[model samples]
Target: MRLFHSPASPYVRKVMVTAYERGVEDQIEILGSAAGPVKRDPEIVKHNSSGKVPCALLENDTPLFDSRVICAYLDSLAGREGTVYPQGADRFDVLTLEALGDAILDACLLCRYEAVLRPESLRWDDWYAGQMAKVDSGLDDLEGKWFERISGAFHAGSIAVVCALGYLDFRFSDKDWRSTHPKLAAWFAEVSERRSMKETLPKG
Candidate 1:
């Protein structure tokens, strides 16, 4: 399998981490692909219509896209049933959490694009604040409702949350999220020490 990856993308990190947890990291070959809203890599476009990084091309020439889909596919390939993703009703809960984590990342990435990608004169403070509000609300939901659900099992949901938090640390270090949600912060600290996360920590 070949993965088009960007070192700075949290989505890519999520897929890489999932691959590591599934014990399939060694099977994947990473191909550098830098893609952003304004900057699209043609190589990634050949595999993913959206021109997104973290797109995987299987040995059979099958293309997988989006971090969530790629992670699920990798999990299926591992054949480790009921591990990264649970079964039955529990699966829905984990998937919901993964959605929330991805939503948080979406908001954070949008805010980043607004601040850094857009020209200063064209950047809208209100738009940035709105995006950040989504992130804040997502964090509040995680801290208030999902705090006790973090089992340190390194499942898909937990991995997504960790990657989301790591993205904040990488891009919005000025914001002290730790003080606002100590429990979630502490949970992230513990999960982040896992070998999978440690090895896939985002860089650049």
Candidate 2:
């Protein structure tokens, strides 16, 4: 399998981290690309009509897209019946959590592109704030439930939370969200030490 990757993309990091955690990293190849909004390349569009990074090409030549789809596909490659994603209610819960986490990433990416990639005069504070609100609400929801469990069985949900927290560290370090959500912060600190996560830490 070949994964079209960019180092700075948190979504790709999520998939890569999961692959490493499930011991499938060696089965995949990373293909670096600089594609992004306003700089779309036709080659990328061939695999993903959206011309997005993090699309995967499977052995059968099928192209998988979006971070969620890629992650689910990687989970399937794990071979274990109930390891990365589990089964039944546990699986549903993790899937929902992943959904929320992906939504937060989407908002963060859009806000970033609008502010830095677009001219200042064209940036909309209201639109940006709305995205930030999603982040805020997401953190608040997690802050409440995170304390109830220190280290439950690892699932894709926890993976999503960790990735979302990492995104916060990357994009909003000045905000110091950890200070307010000590439990979640501690949880993230614990998970960060894992080799899968350590190896995939964002660079550049």
Candidate 3:
């Protein structure tokens, strides 16, 4: 499997974290690609069609895209030991959390693109503020569910939250989100120690 990825993408980081946790990180090769708001990377479009990062190309060249799908496919590949995603009710729980976490990432990425990718004069403060509000609310919700969701070892939900938080650290440090969500901050501190997460920490 080859992963179309970029170091700065939280979605890509989620997939990489999952792959490492499954002990199949080496089975997947990381192929650099343009991601987030970039729209004209031909090689990315050639493999992913949608030109998105965090997409996995299987040996047969079938591409699995979007972080959730790639992570699920990787989980299937790992069989029983890849219990990060459970099969039944617990699976839905993780998926739900994954969706919430990805929503946060979406807002974060959108704000980043609007500020850096778009012309400054065209930047809409209201639109960016809306995205920030989503992130703030998302963090609040996570703080409420912190203990219930983080009691276990690393899972899809846990991994998603970690990636989301890490993205904030990388891109939205000025927001000082950790200062408000102390429980989440503490949880992240502990989870950050995991070898899988430590290895996949995002770069520019």
Steric clashes per prediction: 0, 0, 0
- Per-residue C-alpha lDDT of model 3 across residues 59-146, encoded as one tens digit per residue: 7888789899998888888898657887776878877888888999989889998889999999999999999999999999998965
Which parts of model 3 have CA positions greater than 4 angstroms off? none
Model 2 TM-score, 2 decimals:
0.93
Q: Which clashing pairs does model 3 show?
A: none
Question: Pick by lDDT: which candidate is best?
Answer: 1
lDDT of 1 by residue, 1-204 (tens): 888998899999999899888898998898988787877898888778889887999877689988999999889989966468988666788888899899999999999999998999999999999999999998998899876665546688888899999999999999999999988998888888888889987889
Rank candidates by lDDT, best first: 1, 3, 2
Error of 1 at 175 (Å): 0.8
Model 1: which residue pairs collide? none
| Candidate 1 deviant stretches above 4 angstroms | none
Q: Mind giving the per-residue lDDT tens digits that candidate 2 earns over 74-115?
A: 888888765677776666777777787788788888888877
Clashing pairs in 2: none
Q: Please rank every candidate by TM-score, starting with the best.
A: 1, 3, 2
TM-score of each: 0.96, 0.93, 0.94
